[model samples]
Target: MSVMVAVPDSAEGALALTSAIAEARLLGTDVLAVNLGLRPISPEHLMSGETRITILERTHHESHAEVVLHALAEHPETERLVIGVKRRSKVGKALIGSVSQTLLLEADVPILAVKLPH
Candidate 1:
Protein backbone atom coordinates (compact mmCIF):
# COMPACT_ATOMS: atom_id res chain seq x y z
CA MET A 1 0.00 0.00 0.00
CA SER A 2 1.02 3.61 -0.44
CA VAL A 3 0.35 7.04 0.98
CA MET A 4 -1.59 9.53 -1.13
CA VAL A 5 -1.01 13.24 -0.70
CA ALA A 6 -2.55 16.13 -2.60
CA VAL A 7 0.00 18.79 -3.40
CA PRO A 8 -1.73 22.08 -4.12
CA ASP A 9 0.22 25.13 -5.25
CA SER A 10 0.48 26.58 -1.78
CA ALA A 11 2.89 26.56 1.13
CA GLU A 12 0.35 24.73 3.22
CA GLY A 13 0.18 22.02 0.60
CA ALA A 14 3.96 21.73 0.65
CA LEU A 15 3.74 21.20 4.39
CA ALA A 16 1.22 18.44 3.79
CA LEU A 17 3.60 16.76 1.33
CA THR A 18 6.41 16.92 3.89
CA SER A 19 4.21 15.38 6.57
CA ALA A 20 3.10 12.64 4.20
CA ILE A 21 6.72 11.87 3.28
CA ALA A 22 7.61 11.50 6.94
CA GLU A 23 4.66 9.17 7.44
CA ALA A 24 5.62 7.14 4.38
CA ARG A 25 9.17 6.81 5.67
CA LEU A 26 7.91 5.58 9.02
CA LEU A 27 5.62 3.07 7.32
CA GLY A 28 8.17 2.05 4.65
CA THR A 29 5.72 2.71 1.83
CA ASP A 30 5.79 4.65 -1.39
CA VAL A 31 4.18 8.07 -1.83
CA LEU A 32 1.88 9.30 -4.55
CA ALA A 33 1.83 13.10 -4.72
CA VAL A 34 -0.98 14.37 -6.87
CA ASN A 35 -0.74 17.85 -8.36
CA LEU A 36 -4.08 19.04 -9.64
CA GLY A 37 -3.17 22.69 -9.61
CA LEU A 38 -2.44 24.84 -12.61
CA ARG A 39 1.21 25.54 -11.77
CA PRO A 40 3.87 22.87 -11.87
CA ILE A 41 4.86 21.21 -8.65
CA SER A 42 8.54 21.81 -7.99
CA PRO A 43 11.07 19.08 -7.13
CA GLU A 44 12.19 21.27 -4.25
CA HIS A 45 8.75 20.77 -2.73
CA LEU A 46 9.76 17.18 -2.16
CA MET A 47 12.35 17.63 0.58
CA SER A 48 12.28 14.06 1.77
CA GLY A 49 15.19 11.74 1.08
CA GLU A 50 15.42 8.11 0.04
CA THR A 51 11.77 7.56 -0.71
CA ARG A 52 9.96 6.59 -3.88
CA ILE A 53 7.65 9.37 -5.03
CA THR A 54 5.32 9.29 -8.00
CA ILE A 55 4.08 12.64 -9.26
CA LEU A 56 0.68 12.79 -10.94
CA GLU A 57 -0.42 15.99 -12.61
CA ARG A 58 -3.84 16.93 -13.86
CA THR A 59 -5.80 20.02 -14.75
CA HIS A 60 -8.01 21.85 -12.25
CA HIS A 61 -11.11 20.96 -14.15
CA GLU A 62 -12.84 19.51 -11.11
CA SER A 63 -12.96 20.73 -7.57
CA HIS A 64 -9.94 19.85 -5.43
CA ALA A 65 -11.97 17.64 -3.18
CA GLU A 66 -13.48 15.88 -6.14
CA VAL A 67 -10.06 15.22 -7.63
CA VAL A 68 -8.77 13.80 -4.38
CA LEU A 69 -11.84 11.67 -3.87
CA HIS A 70 -11.39 10.27 -7.38
CA ALA A 71 -7.76 9.52 -6.64
CA LEU A 72 -8.73 7.63 -3.51
CA ALA A 73 -11.21 5.55 -5.45
CA GLU A 74 -8.66 4.76 -8.20
CA HIS A 75 -5.78 3.88 -5.84
CA PRO A 76 -7.12 0.95 -3.89
CA GLU A 77 -3.70 0.39 -2.37
CA THR A 78 -3.56 3.82 -0.85
CA GLU A 79 -3.21 3.39 2.89
CA ARG A 80 -4.62 6.80 3.66
CA LEU A 81 -5.05 10.37 2.45
CA VAL A 82 -2.94 13.31 3.58
CA ILE A 83 -3.85 16.96 3.07
CA GLY A 84 -3.10 20.39 4.52
CA VAL A 85 -5.61 22.45 6.49
CA LYS A 86 -5.05 26.14 6.58
CA ARG A 87 -6.10 27.90 9.75
CA ARG A 88 -9.36 29.57 8.96
CA SER A 89 -11.84 31.35 11.11
CA LYS A 90 -15.24 29.79 11.57
CA VAL A 91 -16.73 32.41 9.28
CA GLY A 92 -14.09 31.75 6.66
CA LYS A 93 -14.58 28.03 6.87
CA ALA A 94 -18.32 28.37 6.62
CA LEU A 95 -18.04 30.79 3.73
CA ILE A 96 -15.39 28.94 1.73
CA GLY A 97 -16.17 25.37 2.72
CA SER A 98 -13.15 23.06 3.09
CA VAL A 99 -11.46 20.47 0.91
CA SER A 100 -9.99 18.66 3.89
CA GLN A 101 -13.38 18.58 5.49
CA THR A 102 -14.93 17.12 2.37
CA LEU A 103 -12.27 14.42 2.11
CA LEU A 104 -12.52 13.56 5.76
CA LEU A 105 -16.18 12.87 5.20
CA GLU A 106 -15.97 11.17 1.78
CA ALA A 107 -12.76 9.14 1.76
CA ASP A 108 -13.00 5.47 2.65
CA VAL A 109 -9.38 5.44 3.82
CA PRO A 110 -7.95 7.22 6.80
CA ILE A 111 -7.36 10.95 6.35
CA LEU A 112 -4.50 12.93 7.86
CA ALA A 113 -5.02 16.69 7.98
CA VAL A 114 -1.78 18.55 8.57
CA LYS A 115 -1.60 22.19 9.51
CA LEU A 116 1.20 24.60 8.74
CA PRO A 117 3.51 25.45 11.61
CA HIS A 118 2.79 28.66 13.41
Candidate 2:
Protein backbone atom coordinates (compact mmCIF):
# COMPACT_ATOMS: atom_id res chain seq x y z
CA MET A 1 0.00 0.00 0.00
CA SER A 2 1.10 3.60 -0.53
CA VAL A 3 1.90 5.92 2.39
CA MET A 4 2.31 9.67 2.06
CA VAL A 5 4.56 11.69 4.37
CA ALA A 6 5.18 15.45 4.39
CA VAL A 7 8.83 16.23 5.00
CA PRO A 8 9.59 19.81 5.97
CA ASP A 9 12.76 21.71 5.04
CA SER A 10 14.95 21.04 8.04
CA ALA A 11 17.60 18.57 9.18
CA GLU A 12 15.38 17.33 12.04
CA GLY A 13 12.55 16.95 9.58
CA ALA A 14 14.76 15.01 7.18
CA LEU A 15 16.00 12.67 9.89
CA ALA A 16 12.48 12.07 11.18
CA LEU A 17 11.35 11.54 7.59
CA THR A 18 14.06 8.98 6.86
CA SER A 19 13.20 7.12 10.03
CA ALA A 20 9.51 7.04 9.21
CA ILE A 21 10.13 5.91 5.63
CA ALA A 22 12.58 3.27 6.74
CA GLU A 23 10.09 1.92 9.26
CA ALA A 24 7.35 1.90 6.67
CA ARG A 25 9.68 0.05 4.30
CA LEU A 26 10.28 -2.59 6.95
CA LEU A 27 6.53 -2.89 7.28
CA GLY A 28 6.23 -3.59 3.54
CA THR A 29 4.65 -0.29 2.50
CA ASP A 30 5.41 2.14 -0.31
CA VAL A 31 6.61 5.47 1.11
CA LEU A 32 6.26 8.78 -0.67
CA ALA A 33 7.85 11.90 0.78
CA VAL A 34 6.02 15.14 0.04
CA ASN A 35 9.07 17.32 -0.15
CA LEU A 36 7.99 20.90 -0.66
CA GLY A 37 10.92 22.79 -2.26
CA LEU A 38 13.73 20.90 -0.54
CA ARG A 39 13.94 17.91 -2.87
CA PRO A 40 16.56 15.29 -2.36
CA ILE A 41 19.27 16.21 -4.88
CA SER A 42 20.70 12.70 -4.77
CA PRO A 43 18.59 9.70 -5.65
CA GLU A 44 17.19 7.91 -2.59
CA HIS A 45 19.59 5.37 -1.16
CA LEU A 46 18.74 1.79 -2.09
CA MET A 47 19.72 0.53 1.34
CA SER A 48 17.02 2.84 2.61
CA GLY A 49 14.56 1.08 0.30
CA GLU A 50 12.24 2.37 -2.44
CA THR A 51 10.64 5.76 -1.81
CA ARG A 52 9.24 8.28 -4.27
CA ILE A 53 9.95 11.83 -3.15
CA THR A 54 7.76 14.44 -4.83
CA ILE A 55 9.01 18.01 -4.50
CA LEU A 56 6.72 20.99 -4.92
CA GLU A 57 8.86 23.96 -5.92
CA ARG A 58 5.83 26.24 -6.17
CA THR A 59 4.57 25.39 -2.68
CA HIS A 60 7.50 26.43 -0.53
CA HIS A 61 5.85 29.64 0.63
CA GLU A 62 2.29 28.47 1.02
CA SER A 63 1.24 26.35 4.00
CA HIS A 64 2.88 22.94 3.63
CA ALA A 65 -0.12 21.30 5.27
CA GLU A 66 -2.25 22.70 2.46
CA VAL A 67 0.29 21.62 -0.13
CA VAL A 68 0.54 18.01 1.05
CA LEU A 69 -3.19 17.64 1.54
CA HIS A 70 -3.77 18.93 -1.99
CA ALA A 71 -1.12 16.52 -3.24
CA LEU A 72 -2.79 13.60 -1.46
CA ALA A 73 -6.07 14.67 -2.99
CA GLU A 74 -4.54 14.65 -6.46
CA HIS A 75 -2.62 11.39 -6.22
CA PRO A 76 -4.50 8.13 -6.41
CA GLU A 77 -1.50 6.25 -5.05
CA THR A 78 -1.75 7.92 -1.68
CA GLU A 79 -3.31 5.41 0.72
CA ARG A 80 -2.37 6.90 4.07
CA LEU A 81 -0.40 9.88 5.45
CA VAL A 82 2.30 10.31 8.10
CA ILE A 83 4.05 13.43 9.40
CA GLY A 84 6.35 14.51 12.22
CA VAL A 85 5.30 16.78 15.06
CA LYS A 86 8.09 18.36 17.04
CA ARG A 87 7.02 19.14 20.57
CA ARG A 88 5.87 22.72 20.95
CA SER A 89 4.97 25.00 23.82
CA LYS A 90 1.62 26.81 23.71
CA VAL A 91 3.32 30.09 22.87
CA GLY A 92 5.29 28.47 20.08
CA LYS A 93 2.20 26.81 18.70
CA ALA A 94 0.36 30.13 18.89
CA LEU A 95 3.19 32.04 17.20
CA ILE A 96 3.52 29.47 14.42
CA GLY A 97 0.76 26.97 14.03
CA SER A 98 1.92 23.38 13.58
CA VAL A 99 1.33 21.40 10.40
CA SER A 100 0.42 18.41 12.55
CA GLN A 101 -2.42 20.46 13.97
CA THR A 102 -3.67 21.36 10.52
CA LEU A 103 -3.37 17.82 9.17
CA LEU A 104 -5.00 16.32 12.24
CA LEU A 105 -7.89 18.72 11.97
CA GLU A 106 -8.30 18.97 8.20
CA ALA A 107 -6.97 15.95 6.33
CA ASP A 108 -9.59 13.59 4.91
CA VAL A 109 -7.29 10.56 5.05
CA PRO A 110 -5.86 8.77 8.06
CA ILE A 111 -2.87 10.65 9.47
CA LEU A 112 -0.16 9.14 11.66
CA ALA A 113 1.31 11.94 13.68
CA VAL A 114 4.85 11.12 14.83
CA LYS A 115 5.46 13.08 17.97
CA LEU A 116 9.09 14.00 18.47
CA PRO A 117 10.48 14.28 21.98
CA HIS A 118 11.14 17.74 23.29
Candidate 3:
Protein backbone atom coordinates (compact mmCIF):
# COMPACT_ATOMS: atom_id res chain seq x y z
CA MET A 1 0.00 0.00 0.00
CA SER A 2 1.04 3.58 -0.57
CA VAL A 3 0.26 7.00 0.84
CA MET A 4 -1.34 9.49 -1.52
CA VAL A 5 -1.21 13.26 -1.09
CA ALA A 6 -2.71 16.19 -2.98
CA VAL A 7 -0.12 18.90 -3.50
CA PRO A 8 -1.67 22.28 -4.18
CA ASP A 9 -0.01 25.70 -4.43
CA SER A 10 -0.12 26.64 -0.80
CA ALA A 11 1.79 26.36 2.45
CA GLU A 12 -0.76 23.85 3.72
CA GLY A 13 -0.01 21.69 0.68
CA ALA A 14 3.70 21.72 1.59
CA LEU A 15 2.85 20.75 5.14
CA ALA A 16 0.60 17.95 3.92
CA LEU A 17 3.36 16.65 1.66
CA THR A 18 5.77 16.59 4.58
CA SER A 19 3.23 14.85 6.78
CA ALA A 20 2.51 12.25 4.06
CA ILE A 21 6.22 11.53 3.74
CA ALA A 22 6.46 10.87 7.46
CA GLU A 23 3.41 8.67 7.43
CA ALA A 24 4.75 6.72 4.45
CA ARG A 25 7.97 6.11 6.37
CA LEU A 26 6.01 4.77 9.32
CA LEU A 27 3.89 2.58 7.08
CA GLY A 28 6.92 1.40 5.08
CA THR A 29 5.34 2.43 1.77
CA ASP A 30 5.89 4.77 -1.12
CA VAL A 31 4.16 8.08 -1.80
CA LEU A 32 1.91 9.03 -4.72
CA ALA A 33 1.49 12.76 -4.94
CA VAL A 34 -1.04 14.35 -7.28
CA ASN A 35 0.16 17.73 -8.37
CA LEU A 36 -2.87 20.01 -8.40
CA GLY A 37 -0.94 23.22 -8.64
CA LEU A 38 0.63 25.05 -11.54
CA ARG A 39 4.06 25.07 -9.97
CA PRO A 40 6.15 21.96 -10.25
CA ILE A 41 7.15 20.07 -7.13
CA SER A 42 10.74 18.91 -7.00
CA PRO A 43 11.01 15.51 -5.38
CA GLU A 44 14.64 16.11 -4.40
CA HIS A 45 13.76 19.22 -2.37
CA LEU A 46 10.97 17.67 -0.31
CA MET A 47 12.02 14.03 -0.08
CA SER A 48 14.81 12.75 2.16
CA GLY A 49 15.94 10.00 -0.29
CA GLU A 50 14.19 7.32 1.72
CA THR A 51 10.71 6.84 0.34
CA ARG A 52 10.10 6.82 -3.38
CA ILE A 53 7.69 9.47 -4.68
CA THR A 54 5.62 9.35 -7.83
CA ILE A 55 4.21 12.64 -9.03
CA LEU A 56 1.05 12.67 -11.12
CA GLU A 57 0.16 15.72 -13.11
CA ARG A 58 -3.44 16.84 -13.02
CA THR A 59 -5.52 17.50 -16.12
CA HIS A 60 -7.14 20.89 -16.51
CA HIS A 61 -10.63 19.51 -17.04
CA GLU A 62 -10.97 18.07 -13.55
CA SER A 63 -11.16 19.89 -10.25
CA HIS A 64 -8.53 19.29 -7.63
CA ALA A 65 -10.85 17.04 -5.65
CA GLU A 66 -11.86 15.14 -8.77
CA VAL A 67 -8.24 14.54 -9.73
CA VAL A 68 -7.47 13.13 -6.29
CA LEU A 69 -10.53 10.90 -6.33
CA HIS A 70 -9.61 9.66 -9.77
CA ALA A 71 -6.12 8.88 -8.56
CA LEU A 72 -7.55 6.87 -5.69
CA ALA A 73 -9.68 4.90 -8.12
CA GLU A 74 -6.76 4.33 -10.47
CA HIS A 75 -4.43 3.30 -7.68
CA PRO A 76 -6.27 0.89 -5.45
CA GLU A 77 -3.12 0.20 -3.48
CA THR A 78 -3.35 3.59 -1.83
CA GLU A 79 -3.72 3.03 1.87
CA ARG A 80 -4.44 6.61 2.77
CA LEU A 81 -4.97 10.05 1.29
CA VAL A 82 -3.37 13.24 2.65
CA ILE A 83 -4.76 16.68 1.84
CA GLY A 84 -4.22 20.27 2.96
CA VAL A 85 -7.12 22.18 4.47
CA LYS A 86 -7.70 25.75 5.50
CA ARG A 87 -9.96 27.05 8.23
CA ARG A 88 -13.07 28.59 6.75
CA SER A 89 -16.17 30.05 8.21
CA LYS A 90 -19.53 28.45 7.50
CA VAL A 91 -20.47 31.34 5.28
CA GLY A 92 -17.24 31.11 3.39
CA LYS A 93 -17.61 27.41 2.86
CA ALA A 94 -21.14 27.89 1.67
CA LEU A 95 -20.04 30.54 -0.74
CA ILE A 96 -17.04 28.61 -2.03
CA GLY A 97 -17.05 24.83 -2.12
CA SER A 98 -14.16 23.16 -0.31
CA VAL A 99 -12.11 20.45 -1.99
CA SER A 100 -10.90 18.99 1.31
CA GLN A 101 -14.41 18.76 2.59
CA THR A 102 -15.55 17.04 -0.57
CA LEU A 103 -12.75 14.51 -0.29
CA LEU A 104 -13.55 13.87 3.34
CA LEU A 105 -17.14 13.13 2.46
CA GLU A 106 -16.56 11.19 -0.75
CA ALA A 107 -13.28 9.35 -0.50
CA ASP A 108 -13.53 5.66 0.39
CA VAL A 109 -10.07 5.44 1.97
CA PRO A 110 -8.79 7.03 5.18
CA ILE A 111 -7.94 10.69 4.95
CA LEU A 112 -5.29 12.83 6.62
CA ALA A 113 -6.36 16.46 6.49
CA VAL A 114 -3.63 18.92 7.47
CA LYS A 115 -3.48 22.66 8.00
CA LEU A 116 -0.69 25.21 8.11
CA PRO A 117 1.18 25.56 11.38
CA HIS A 118 -0.02 28.37 13.58
What are the per-residue Cα lDDT tens digits for candidate 3 across 36-97? Answer: 98989865547546898889888757888999999999999999999989988889988998
Q: Mind sharing the TM-score for model 1?
A: 0.92
lDDT of every predicted structure (CA atoms): 0.86, 0.67, 0.90
lDDT (C-alpha) at residue 66 in model 3: 93
Cα lDDT of model 2 by residue, 7-90, tens digit: 766644565566657766666776777775455523543245355444434353667878887887777666677787787778
Question: What TM-score do all the candidates reach, one by one?
Answer: 0.92, 0.72, 0.92
Model 1 RMSD vs true structure: 1.4
Per-residue lDDT of model 1, residues 1-118, tens digit only: 9999999889878888898998899999989998966787787877678888888776448898998888878889999788998899889988987888888888999888998778
Cα misplacement distance, residue 21 of candidate 3 (Å): 0.1
Clashing pairs in 1: none
Each model's number of backbone clashes?
Answer: 0, 0, 0
Error of 2 at 22 (Å): 3.5
> Of the pair 2 and 3, which is ahead by TM-score?
3
